[model samples]
Target: MQIGFFAVGIGPSADPEIIALTARTAEQAGFHSLWAPEHVVLIDQYASRYPYSQDGKLPMSTKVDILDPFVALTFAAAHTKTIRLGTGICLVPERSPVVTAKEIASLDKLSGGRFDFGVGVGWLAEEFTAVGVPWERRAERTREYLKAMKLLWTEEEPQFTGEFCSFPKVRLYPKPVQKPHPPILFGGESTPALKRVAEVGDGWFGVNVTVEDAKAKIERIRSYAQAAGRDPGKFRFMVSPGLGLPVELDMIKRYRDAGVHQVALGAIPRDAKGIKGEIERLAEKLVVPAAKL
Candidate 1:
């Protein structure tokens, strides 16, 4: 299985120099990809319950500097040759499909086709409200948005007419280098999320899941794929075991056995002062060893 680093490119590590160094270090260390999360804006208070945490709270402070994932990945792309850059989970429903499609295609083209579009229908109701997207039908909207983006990416003169998105036949330039566009990896662990993956996603991105849970979830996703008449083997599964989990050989093997195509480990440095050392140690201790096996 491939190993990747789930980078929190925001907060103290948001410096351009640090981002460049991390990407170069990860690429040289044999990591398959460098994934970053997205949060366009954060509210001071919210009623939304974060699903990954035990107490349903966001892990980071609200004041943290969350960078735009695509822009950050674009910078990383300019600094590295091989390591793939991905948005660990881009909130699709909150953004315009047309502009987002252009950004995705532009990033893919400029990065030599090294972009993975991991997306979700977001959980923060207040944020969604702030962005002017109704929370009630966000999932349906997200699905339609993905469809709309695909049309723009594949067709020479693309047009889309859906409940949430509609546009006349118009030409979009700089089509993505990756055939049929970059891989669309959907993130979430709920049943609807799994069904969405089977229906539209190129892969499944499971977050905060254990080995045993991953096994079951993969099986369910495969079953859903079969139900939808899609080959289960064509889909990929990636998991990012919640932050602070031990990254060891046995755990890596367990994830591989559970059908994970890639495992993304949280590489949050203790602080900006120790970023380089942390990257080297994570590579030497976990990423490099895991890649060899």
Candidate 2:
């Protein structure tokens, strides 16, 4: 039963001082990890439905300044020692795999091997169009790009050939500090997403699932893994439960009972002092009690 916060570098906390303060405070308060969300650019008008909300619109404004997850987490890495850092969901089809691999390897090296790679195919069709990446067959492209990145991370003479990505034997220096690259946690709740978990994921990251949803999804993932000859026991389960806004211990107990390994919370405060106070409150209210659970 570990805990993490959704993001640090956005809105009022986007400043360098605030990012450092948030990271240091969370680590000191006994939080296990810090995560950051990513969106290359938000369109003022888009038709893509935000999966997490009821009105088919993200609750955020287009004016929100979302610092790049890598840059933000790098700030966190330099500021804190023990807190693990992650991209809550890096949209895979939007960037070149080579560039992404290098960034991830560098982050892992700098962070002392504490990086969790969370990835998703993406939901915003318009954003993909604006980024000049195809909106169709993106999941397939995501699968290919990730495998290509794997070759870059793990192979001595890395090479890959696929519909979306291919490279001749080459070298990438400072391969990830983790043995075989950082553990990739696949995000999304679609059937295809679960199948992606079966294909190459080290874990399934459920966004906004309930206790029952998490349980059912975990079982489905297990079955998918077994069907794919993957050992389900080795896969970690992380959930960003949609339960309590000010999360409750009892809600945590339910998720723990459902076999969730880590609970990543969201809607954290945006200002420096508010971030510190929230971490302190969460540490007192949930971190201490949940650790015992």
Quote the lDDT for 31 in model 1: 82
Provide the TM-score for each candidate, comma-separated: 0.97, 0.98
> What are the per-model numbers of colliding residue pairs?
0, 0
| TM accuracy, model 1 | 0.97
Off by over 4 Å in 2: none
Give the worst 10-residue stretch by lDDT in candidate 1: 266-275
| Model 2 Cα lDDT, one tens digit per residue, 43-149 | 99898999998898988789988888999999899999999999888998999999999999999999999999999999899999989999999999999999899
> Candidate 2, after superposition: displacement of residue 31 in Å?
0.6
Stretches of candidate 1 off by over 4 Å are: 270-273
